[model samples]
Target: MTDAPQTNAPEPPPRHIESAALLQGAREIVIEHAGQCYRLLVTKNDKLILQK
Candidate 1:
């Protein structure tokens, strides 16, 4: 009767990172619209650097 669509429950966070089928350790994220993959590395002094 309502115009709203039904939605399911949200998924829980992963508990294990050692498994090869799952991903983990996601901190601050910066998405680029130019189709480039970037890895960021931080130091103790809060300095940001590009990671290999």
Candidate 2:
């Protein structure tokens, strides 16, 4: 019996962002997409939440 060859999936590119630079002391940021507005918020737990 012959063994099958193994293949690995391609990896995605890395992304980097400086949160302080984007937020700048703001708790929330407004995003416009497809003519709609959404809110990206930073929670007290230092996590992010997005809402429409």
Candidate 3:
């Protein structure tokens, strides 16, 4: 029996999106998943926080 040869393949880069696009001029936005709600907030420090 002979084993198959292996090959190395490069992975694609991850997708990127701007925070302004997601928030759309809002301080917070709600996301729904698995029958649950989550809040994505932007603080005064210009950082992001995810809450359940």
Candidate 4:
């Protein structure tokens, strides 16, 4: 009996950023993509909401 060889590759780690750093004291920020505008908002409950 012969064993098969493994050829698995390691994955790169994901990037992380703090919400405070991204928002920079702003309650909301706009993001533009594909000629469209989107809003990223910090809600009253302190949750994030994305809208187009």
Q: Write down the TM-score of every candidate.
A: 0.27, 0.62, 0.70, 0.68
- Output the lDDT of residue 37, model 1: 62
Query: What tens digits encode model 2's per-residue C-alpha lDDT throughout 1-52?
Result: 9999876977778878887877899999998999999998999999999999
Could you report the Cα RMSD, in angstroms, for every candidate shown?
Answer: 8.1, 7.0, 4.5, 6.6
lDDT-wise, the better of 2 and 3 is 3
Stretches of model 4 off by over 4 angstroms after superposition: 1-11
Ranking by TM-score: 3, 4, 2, 1
Residue 44 in candidate 4 has what lDDT? 100
Error of 4 at 50 (Å): 0.5
Q: Score candidate 4 by lDDT.
A: 0.94
Q: What does the lDDT read for residue 14 in candidate 4?
A: 82
For candidate 1, which ten residues in a row score worst on lDDT? 19-28
For candidate 1, the TM-score is 0.27
**Total colliding residue pairs, candidate 1:** 0
lDDT, each prediction = 0.51, 0.90, 0.95, 0.94
User: TM-score of model 4 relative to the true fold?
Assistant: 0.68
Summarize candidate 3's per-residue lDDT along 1-52 as a digit string, tens digits.
9999876877779889998999999999999999999999999999999999
